[model samples]
Target: MVTVSAEESLDHGVPAPMRRGEVFTIHATRDDRSMITHRILPEIAVAQARQLNDAGWQVHISELGGRAFKPSEFYQLLSYKRIG
Candidate 1:
């Protein structure tokens, strides 16, 4: 399944600390491959996930839980298998 989520920004390939209300980097991953968008607002992340869903990709949004600093909290999880 494909999963969409957000994470803190990276500096030189290292994760940078984020302040509350800061922008996030969106991550969409399936198996070993990943797609990333940097410095995006939460709404844009959701829109992208929705677009993928509309295009017949099963997408899952990460839920708000685990680490209190989770950037994934910005959007709901979308998960799906490809429709035949």
Candidate 2:
């Protein structure tokens, strides 16, 4: 498993410390595409992912420093609003 420093995890767009093995969630968007990835705490991540998925987003659960990770997930959850 890839270990993430406390500074690397985030909550609510704010940088905060995370436990050694703690994971978090990240939402990303580009043009008309969007996905939610998890580096998330299972307690909350799963629920959040399900919620986003229910809203029609592609949700993925991944490790903190695992493959397919985008650095931006550590920053924020992007808007997934659909266009007309």
Clashes of each: 10, 5
User: For model 2, where is the 10-residue window of minimal lDDT?
Assistant: 75-84
Look at candidate 2 and give me any clashing residue pairs. Answer: 23-39, 23-40, 23-41, 24-39, 24-40
The lDDT of each candidate is 0.41, 0.44
Question: Which pairs of residues clash in candidate 1, taking residues 3 or more apart in a chain or in different chains?
Answer: 58-80, 59-78, 59-79, 59-80, 60-77, 60-78, 60-79, 61-77, 61-78, 62-77
lDDT (Cα) of model 1: 0.41
Please tell me which predicted candidate would have the highest TM-score against the true structure: 2
> For this target, which candidate reaches the highest lDDT against the unseen true structure?
2
lDDT of 1 by residue, 7-80 (tens): 54333432222232234344455666666544334455567656755665444433222222223343432232
TM-score for each candidate, following the candidate numbering: 0.34, 0.40
Stretches > 4 Å off in candidate 1: 1-40, 63-84
